[model samples]
Target: MHEITFSTVDKPKLLSQLTSLLAEIGLNIQEAHAFSTADGFSLDVFVVDGWREETEELKSVLERGILKYKEQYLSKRHVVSSVNEHYQVKIEPLSNCIAIPSDGTDVWEIDTTQLKTENKVGSGSFGDLYRGTYCSQEVAIKVLKPERVNAEMLREFSQEVYIMRKIRHKNVVQFIGACTRPPNLCIVTEFMSRGSVYDFLHKQRGVFKLPSLLKVGIDVSKGMNYLHQNNIIHRDLKTANLLMDENEVVKVADFGVARVQAQSGVMTAETGTYRWMAPEVIEHKPYDQKADVFSFGISLWELLTGELPYSYLTPLQAAVGVVQKGLRPTIPKNTHPRLAELLERCWQQDPTNRPDFSEILDILQHIKRK
Candidate 1:
């Protein structure tokens, strides 16, 4: 009888291992113990194996199992295989970021080995967000549904690579790298452990604090200011798109909707979510950076109110209310008066009249200081 433990892996591996070993000599498992603990899991396996194979064959089979599982196991990266070999594997390259060092030796590529993948963090029309790693550093990986996403989206994936290769900003979600190989349309980015501002505002209210909110506002403003300065308009600015670092610093995300200055006039065949979009965008009028400004305004409202403005309303309903009923977001009764005033300026009917992101930055900074 040999007792095996799984600190991480759950089922099939252990059961498969037992079955495979038993099948080797036509033996049966008489006693078994599969116990779980916070630290790991344990299994006491007893077998009825009176007749056995040659010693060399048994060791060779065990060796194969060890090597295979070693690639899939982590947190124990340097796993021993067959008492003769040791190895570690990850899907991502071994570097702090995607860029290779100028002098060489820093360059690496993804190993074909299947990796340990976590459950989805967020799933959308685009794909599922997964928290994963390469080498040893943490990373956030987005896995797109190949068949579901059309060829147009594949172009957007290329655009992300182009954008990330040229741009850098403190408050923006940094793109680390991308996987373009077959069966994978993965985009990698720096891991944001704290999640998004939306979580802090509504979902995580029980754990929210004033200091965190102030920091988030400052970081958000900084990120927007960077985009505005670069003449980039993030048409899809929303809560789920905003990501946070371990320090609670906010970074504007989803530049897939961004419009470069020359391309700013291009229009989507349809439109973004009506609730967060400006009336002009909904009307399909010629628009500019102010479109993002409008979304930012709603995002701020979400921060103050601890709920998405008009989130309870359906898309058709929100549009009707905005166009006909003139539904405007109201300030949270308990919020600071100064913030209420800034939000009012942000949601103004005339995009031209709204403060530019440069001015917006100043306003948020002032509020943070107070």
Candidate 2:
């Protein structure tokens, strides 16, 4: 495998551009390594095959692309800085505040007074989620806990807020707005009355009819397909991240750890909870959107059986079993053969063998018709 490396400031869409450049050279990437320092400087590496007689030409193209990327980044920063001078948006000053891009993105800046926080609903690594009302509408407010407020965490929260603003899909949670005030940074989204799928399935001892299970599968696949099409990777895809509405329609939620696809068609660092994490991810190997598909397989199994995968084992045990022994959750004997087959494909040891979300959607649609 041929290896390539570079470093740049971490930003959205940077990976898409790098991967697009590699593909333009007709290289089939086999592995990727990416990491960032505390100051947002990213180091990326890629391993590839399928080299033709155009190696020299490929080098020239990559060198030119890197220069172009730096130029564009500088230009965009200059423009945003200039626009912020004239814009009257009330932004609270904080040492940990993320630089919100002001290039006409539709991220609504909600006044802090408009949101009314009620009871706490859940908690995440960085924030406490609450049931709240915004502009007379029920919403979920994720407030970054004061103790966790830091440059890195704030940057991640900002990234999630920015990404949520750009996505609009029935299968994806709707972003309402955000309160950028210091000591109370919050992200607000349309609340799903039914809460998360994990609670519906395991916590409440819920069972799903085959038809309903198929529908849930389709909904998640559709959302993921849209994300992939936009070159985004929902690094953490699990039942807990899937919310249900009053009608039980599933919508993808929680993006604090999600990221835009990197230049190597994969990211190097480990992410997502271990139970739903792919083997590649667990091992800190290179992984791309296919990693999400692996998580979906475990989620689909959970939907079908209403049981946690490897319930008897610790998360670390399950992760070890998956990575070291290629173990997968056992399918219920009564499960449909087709469904079992689909799950196997999704959790394939070789990520390249796993089908994309679009194909997964088609298969679910076919199952729904049966």
Candidate 3:
């Protein structure tokens, strides 16, 4: 086994270096861990050979590379026996218990009980999303693990559901209801049988057509406008959080990490997916509703290109690139002029420079009307 250790005062810098190293060796990443430690930080990466028998030579190269990181802070790089960290929940399949409600709009208990506990469609950081039914209706259900759902998380979850129920917007994914039972702390939502926009755009290539893409963009902007008007900020606005039904109706889902933006500095918990975070968020600066707008801006770009912004970089790295490199998203060929303009406005460096959701919605409506 070969190990290389190092440390850095700047987390982002060290991360870039590690990524550079990984990219050089043509190594396929098996697993990786990069978390904050009390002292500084530690990152463990497991990799395998890209080509033929370069595994032994690569190990030797990594061993020699370890000395480069032993300066100010302690950084360690190593090859261990398949470095696998214990992810909090161990989830299994939730039997496909689907029931399409008579109303064809909502789901009920009789629908949930039929869930095959043995099957799981998808799992997120906070919960596992299952494909269950209401009658003839198949829906995706997000159930929080008993031990994992803390008071704070629950508060977030409840507030999100409440806010969702209050607002009836096209872009916003409508909330069903929570399973009140203990241990089965679950939220039944509109079954976006097709899954998240992230999966659709990146994973499900060839699925999106031009009109559908623009339609999704228009829907998302409307949802953002709704939230902003309601004085809410979706801290975790990303493709993964955006759900799409079979009809291709896109709804913004998962407001569990969202917050009501009253004052500028409304800090809740350090919650959210890092990929979509704005630059100011990375700097630990006080952000407002516009920060959510920033995420929407990124999402819009994703919609246009069908690519995740700065996907090649770590979350921290992406944040820094947005800040330092003035890294804006690239537009795809044949993108509409109005969309290109609107997307640019959304990603303005100064959050205030970005257009508000009201204006965004107006522009989208005008574009679609044309």
Candidate 4:
């Protein structure tokens, strides 16, 4: 294996771009590492094979490839003259907030005056989730931090609203409304009182009995099946995105990375968390709705064991293992034979071999009935 390292300015999708460039050069990456420096730079290293050329030749080829990539992809013009100039240029056009395309249906533009925010319930890189009240009804509000607001963030927020507004299911989190006006930009949804399954399992030291486990599996499968039926894929299907209500009902939440599949039924570009990511996705291969099935399998394993998948390895190591060595979380010997079989089928290396959510739901329901 030849080790290659790159250092450049850090930006969104930088890792994905580097990985794609490596793949384009016919490199089979066995290991990968990425680090962000305090000075706003990224250092990425990859150990790869499949290049049978001399080291000097490989270096020349990679240098040329990077130049071509920059010419073809990177912007030539400076995006902003300065921070102040950038803020001034961005704020006015976005002041009215994202304009989601309409299908002549009712829009849920929330009145900020009626929204009452209490304590923060959760936080993420770009936003804070609050336990709030909207017009006397309990709601969870996700507010974007104004300082972090940018074009890409607004696009994601708009896409999420576009998807959420059209979906309504008991097994899926319900969308309430959105305050699309800038600086106060936020999305509101029904409050899930019990928090996330990750917290329930890891924080509270909880374990699901067989019956409850099957119920959770069924709930998630049903939700996924609904999404798949509608041509939507929940690229990130992990315990963290699965939330519970006061009555212990599990519903799939978080659609920030979720997307409606293209007409061709395949997508590229890496999205979602690493540990739960499918092998094809980690490899940046063309993938479809089946990618979500693979993630659901890893998530089902989490529900069964109450342990993080590949807890023994760092996330990048886990990703490399999954793609290079076909690694999966070990199923306990005491696990139900049928469920164990289902897990294996779901983790099949070939996407076609994986069971669809509809089939998975049937299998889980059968296990419960038996």
The prediction achieving the highest TM-score against the true structure is 4
Query: Would you give me the overall lDDT of model 2?
Result: 0.78
Off by more than 4 A, model 4: 1-95
Q: What is the lDDT of residue 66 in candidate 3?
A: 43
lDDT of 4 by residue, 221-299 (tens): 9888998999888888999999999998999999987888878888764467788888877765678899998998998
Q: Quick one: RMSD of model 1?
A: 19.6
Candidate 3 global lDDT: 0.63
What are the per-residue Cα lDDT tens digits for candidate 1 across 2-53? 2222223333234344445445545444332232222333232232333355
Error of 1 at 102 (Å): 17
For 152-244, candidate 2 gives per-residue lDDT tens digits of 567777889878888899999999988776776889999999999999888888898899999999999999999988888998899999999
Q: Please, what is the TM-score per model?
A: 0.65, 0.75, 0.67, 0.78
Model 4 lowest lDDT segment of ten: 77-86
When summed lDDT is taken over every stretch of 10 residues in candidate 2, the lowest stretch is 78-87
What is candidate 2's TM-score against the reference? 0.75
Candidate 2 RMSD to the real structure: 14.0
lDDT tens digits by residue: candidate 3, 1-370? 2222233333444544565665565654433333333344343333333534444566565545544544433355332222112243234333233221243454334244554343588885567877776444555677876645545456656676556656678677766565644457676666776788888777777356657766887788788878887888888889888888778788888877676665644542233555677666554445777777778878878877777787788555665688778887777767789988888888888888988877887887788788
Clashes found in each candidate (C-alpha, N, C closer than 3 A)? 0, 0, 29, 0
Query: Can you rank all candidates by lDDT, best first?
Result: 4, 2, 3, 1
Whole-model lDDT per candidate: 0.61, 0.78, 0.63, 0.83
Question: Which of the predicted structures, 2 or 4, would earn the higher lDDT when compared with the native?
Answer: 4
